[model samples]
Target: KEIKDIVPFSLLTLHNEKYNKLQQSGMSQGKMKALLHNQAIGHLLKKIAPNVPEAILIDQFAKEEVYYSYLNKESVVQTENVYFSTKAEGIHLAVAAASILARYAFIKHFDNLSKAAGFKITKGAGAKVDEAAARLIHEKGLECLPAFVKLHFANTEKAKRLVASKYRK
Candidate 1:
């Protein structure tokens, strides 16, 4: 609904299951970011004709080493067409549109997770998120976290400490 005015030529959705699997496999955040970006580009490239010129502008992920590592692993034929810029959303309409679409997808997935958890799961690694995660741990135990969190975030430790403190009392 948020993208009613935007005509989307290509869309890619990343599921939490896939994210959890990648994180559990010991993939660093930077590399995961790069892999996901590469997958999106690869998906988009498959839709267009081979002769058509395509320029991909992504907002810089702050991990140039990982970005370049995964970018080079993408289809070599289109590697030359990929480009990255700091704050690319401000410079390119396509990037901005993609950001909006990505946000919409995130919100939709968050809503689904919340529904499954029977509670409102807040976003970010703030106090509220930590508290909610602690509550999740309290109700469902730590084993359920990978289904609900990125595991590697500092918030995971915070939430664990919170749950532990509650148990000690």
Candidate 2:
């Protein structure tokens, strides 16, 4: 890859304070997702901003709605070189390349996570993932949850309730 740098950080991990803030902020689900994406992309831009890359590009999530609000409501810096569009993947080589790199890093991170956990830590918030997480909580105990799970997720609550009942009576 000819990219200047590819920085990868896990958002929903024990070390990141953003997860706790997100839980307390009570933002709508859509806004919460946007905040997470914004932070991920923002971190990359901030890191490489020192090098002053040729251009920053992205795949637009929605119309005037999300972007406009994000721009106005937040301190998203944009100069002459930034652009956003629906299918930037199709139109802009940089956007497509970044997307691919991000996906590769994401999968690789989880693969290592699964290895460390001694089980296949499934992706996405479905029953299987819930089951795996609940099992981890049961076997490893609640303290270990922060190490591998996004504690703010509703599924965590459900898992906790299930665990409480299982050990109750």
Candidate 3:
């Protein structure tokens, strides 16, 4: 059976507050990614109890131990069934399809966030992202950023400085 047919579509996100909290707790970025992946897998397993698929192929995002710990704690499914590879997305058709779906969902969410923020929110840690973040602060109060960006990123501080400098102008 096609993975898309057997596994229902699930989109999981870590809100900014949760993301910052985890980061503050000393969780590495890879562990955070594993946390989200575990959530999605757990959700699917609970939704289809007793009919768990034979195997799960995941593109490697974190250490295998990180995923195993999360899955063991949060999922009812067997950990032995899960396999991780550095480039599983390119090797496995199912992983590739899932990657495409995830990218599509991210783009859609980013678009909505841009609309709400009144400008295109840049991705990554580029200088342009700092400019966009500063714009976000200028247009909306700093409080609004929690909904649009990961608060723990250095860009937050950089943006604040930018906004303050603008006031001095």
Could you tell me every candidate's TM-score relative to the true structure?
0.82, 0.64, 0.82
Score candidate 3 by TM-score against the native.
0.82
Best-to-worst order by lDDT is: 3, 1, 2
Give per-residue CA lDDT, model 1, range 47-133, as digits (tens): 554745457776998555657776565543345666778989999888888888878878988998898778999997799999999
For 1-169, candidate 2 gives per-residue lDDT tens digits of 3442553332332232455556557755456555555666667666655666676565777553665474567765553565668788999776777677767667777887788678898988877787777777887888787767777788888778777776565
In candidate 2, stretches whose alpha carbon ends up further than 4 angstroms from where it belongs are 1-17, 27-55, 71-74, 79-81, 152-154, 161-169
- 2 or 3, greater by lDDT: 3
> Candidate 3, 147: how far from true, in Å?
1.6
- Number of the predicted model whose lDDT against the real structure is largest: 3
Q: What tens digits encode model 3's per-residue C-alpha lDDT throughout 49-141? A: 788687988799766776666545554344667888998988888788788778877887788888988778887797899999999988888
For model 1, what is the C-alpha lDDT against the true structure?
0.76
RMSD of each: 2.7, 4.7, 3.2
